[model samples]
Target: MKKWKLGMIVAAAALSVVALAGCTAGKSSSGADDKNVTMWVHFSKEDPEGKAMVQNITAFNKENKKGYKATVQYIPRSGSGGGYEDKINAALNSNSLPDVLTLDGPNTAAYADSKIIQPLGKYITKKSDILPSIIDQGTYKGKLYAVGYSESGVGFYYNKKMFKDAGITEAELPTLDKPWTWDQFNAILKKLTEKYQGPAIDMQLSDHSEMAIYSLAPFVWSAGGNITNKAGTKAVGYFDSAATQSAFKEIQDMVKNGYTTISPKQKGFQTGKYAMLMSGSWTIQELDKQYKDISYGILPYPVSPKTKKLVSPTGSWQYAMSASTTKTAASGALIDFLSAKAQMYRTSMANTVLPARKSVSDEMMSKVTEPMRFLIKQNQESGHARPVLVKYPQVSRTFAETVTKATYYKENPDISALMKKQAQEIQQYLK
Candidate 1:
């Protein structure tokens, strides 16, 4: 759901620590016997996501006939990977890592490159049944090092009542196959702003978090631009390219034209103050349970006028076997079981997250709301995983900061210069 954060000190010490600790690392501190497997996750046991995980582990422990038992420790991350990541970093130095652990999807490359996590391609029993985007996010160096239980997709959630009030017709709404062009989308926003007499969309521009990259990167992709090259080894040309600049300029234009606000009201879309919101599946549950009075519909992301290619962002937390563990067999088994169809369905239903497996989504088609089914379809068809770089956190942070700086600027920000500077800083990490 969010990007993982790695402390600078931990990153700097990674190579030296791995070299010193070697393969026998954490054997003494893991505390798992041959028959027992220990796992770690980043949410509280009381949270819905946490409860679903506990249920999955409970089911795995009861159903598995391999004479293996599993247990979980909840580290409960606060802000962006907060306490959970801190604990993991500490464990990395002390060799106290668990047998299995959950890491954010973007961290697969970093974790695998550092030998903190192990590849599991041979261990996954239902590899083909998993969604391609989910698999794409977890694979690094041509090896599968992680498996996400739930996937994510960002789209435009529009207020149905507000759209109707703005004189928009049902036929004017865009679909996945024929998404509105950027100009058409801008025209719609203008109409909505005219009717509401205020900002028409909530882009959450004030939040300079991972949400920035996760939600906005698709615009860059749709415009035939990238934050880094295909190999993810450099960003100088890609991040500062003309296509990338145009995409950011489009976002900045929304703020400049008063179509969206940097400081939006809390729950503005749910409260009907904004005509639309750009968010992910998590907002589905919140809108249903807390703002049931509001009528909403999900729309495919508006494509670039030039390319008209539909692309939506995708990534979330995933399960990986810890390299420190000696019990590879049991750890792999636990990861596979938790990511299996049944467990993925249960966790996704409870958490209102997008399913990472095709079978799970098919089973949920009749059970989920129309908007959720729409999101699932969007994810299946157009989802694009973020860059899988060893230094992904640094790149993501710089990208997010660029969005924030551009959005809140008083005048037209130098989009090219802004991206150039950030890309140069990110290049240092790429090397």
Candidate 2:
């Protein structure tokens, strides 16, 4: 094992857009009569969803009786280079924050903790309409701070054609009704590895630590281990625990025995090299385009023999109002629009991301294809939301570092000692 420093630089290219003047300050409307609201979204303007989003907002404004209008500012994704935090922080400190903004799941808790975002629980009339698990993602300290707009869950994606070639029956494939135990999952991996020349499984563990952590979470959950305490306030002892150590060892064993490949540079599942890849439904469009011959399906993460039940990690994007906004009413209205059925339809069209509402997911499932339907079902029924707390970002980063070190080192790092040290560092920042 070699000690490696994670270094990758990918710049986010800015989109070309005609600037709207009134949208500069987070103000409502232009003249004394018009109400204007600005939303800073985390998507490229060139993206199809970004185009659809503009159309949806325009339509919403036309129908709005509240005289509310919205302007969308596109923010590029800072891929592996990781400058998103600095951009967000600069925006927040300037008090020029957008009236409404979207945030990734892991960062939601940090925003909520800062009290810079208003909770939607007060203004929302349709709180009951949202899924409990989705709602839980945006809640901090029992207070609902944001509204979930889209959800993604981790699962094993298997190619039906490849399975057929390997002579594995559909019954043998992991499913909701018959999930795989760790041993069973490895057996399938072994078979796939033997049948295929390349890696049996594709586990992306390179630059984006979140991807690795997300892929591995189900195993931790299934093993009765977790990255942090249930409240997410303290780092847990699981990273170096016997259960986690065993899980990492198993993964390493798979790599050594030719059952899996650990690569930082491989293209995602869309390439169709590996028999199975740990991925989310977000990859469906790419898969549909790139691997037309392969019939793919998803299943919950395999259960550990000790846990006896499956656990999958759930992730989502949330909408929140900036505390700096002078127009709370206008921001609330915009948030409401985002949560409405109409906007949800726009979201579905733009990104294949599943809607946060249970009814929306139910309606969308019937209309979508096979694996997506299964993915949504698994997310709704069996998935577990990441624990929400103020220190989530820091904790997640440290957890990723710990996991990577443990997996690469092949020896369990001192979990208790590392956690205690990290806990102290976090407590200082938290206080």
Candidate 3:
């Protein structure tokens, strides 16, 4: 999921305009032949995710009846819009895109609108088997353009020992069906703070990157609010609405009341300095392999007291067909093969990512740990895809900035004004 963030090209506007002007739709450049199909990925071959991808490609070449042989070039991203994205941008300008490529979830609309990628709804064989959240993130304007192999989710990673020490029993803990509300979660935080005499949770507040919005947006949605309209064309009213304000204010109050800190210590939960940590699926791997000193469990996202609705975030890198590809049949076959149940399960298990297919998750329940199964269930039931917009990078950055700004209670006491300023900045990107 973190890698997916790098796929959010900073020069999306330029890519859109230049690609629209330069690309020859339904035309093939180099890299694809009658039998050879080429693709680009954002990870090195040595990476576990990349390794799994290679295995899938090998399996596809051996098993597919179409006799399509696919090869991948790994241009690992160095920074936001570097390496793989840099290559994609240059390729878009020069009209040299490969047959298939991997793109982040949020960039689907921009790529589709600029004719960089073609829709894949008709080509997908197992559309019904794939998670709706995965399909939701990959579709643009009612057309499926991409398919995610894995999904992502954010939740509460609590210290089991710390909870017990605070007199909070296991029975008192929340579940997927009966998740804690904002008020209920706050009460637990207060008790933990009193018992520990320090911060109760680490929200990773100082992180000013994609993580800010990736993890925090669920709070707004759970409050029955949104960052933009359904069409994703406007943000002012939606972003600065009362419901959105209430969500941030509750978090702001946490910072002010010492329930959580703006600058959390590294591995605070594992080291027993914090009772809970707000993080994503990646942390599960770290906790299991690197930080085994503590007992822990993952909890579903807390809902707003008013709405009592549960929502968690979901997005990841996905496979899409380049519009420039003349090998549409072979390319679509490769995509379906990569996103199918067997490959999805393999990559998800090998990479420790959530599977994009319901069947994959169900199969995983028999093999994966309880916490992993819980995350899979929450992702399937409550996952909310991020907004699909052409100017997603700019809009996402502004929304993240708002999260950081709102927590600075003494510096910015008025939530409405802060949201308004952030909304106005995002509006520039929308226009």
lDDT of each: 0.89, 0.70, 0.89
Model 1 global lDDT (CA atoms, 0 to 1): 0.89
Q: For model 1, state the Cα shift of residue 142 in Å.
A: 1.3
Q: Number of backbone collisions per candidate, in order?
A: 0, 3, 0
Model 1 per-residue lDDT at 430: 94
Candidate 3: residue 99 lDDT (0-100): 90
Overall local distance difference test of candidate 3: 0.89
TM-score of each candidate structure, all chains considered together:
0.91, 0.83, 0.92
State how far residue 335 of model 1 sits from its true place (Å). 0.9
Candidate that would win on TM-score: 3
User: What residue pairs are clashing in model 1?
Assistant: none
Worst 10 residues of 1 by lDDT: 23-32
Error of 3 at 266 (Å): 1.6
Ordered by TM-score, highest first, the candidates read 3, 1, 2
lDDT of 3 by residue, 27-106 (tens): 34554366688999999999999899889999999999979999899999886668888889888876889899999998
Cα error, residue 365 of model 1, in Å, equals 1.0
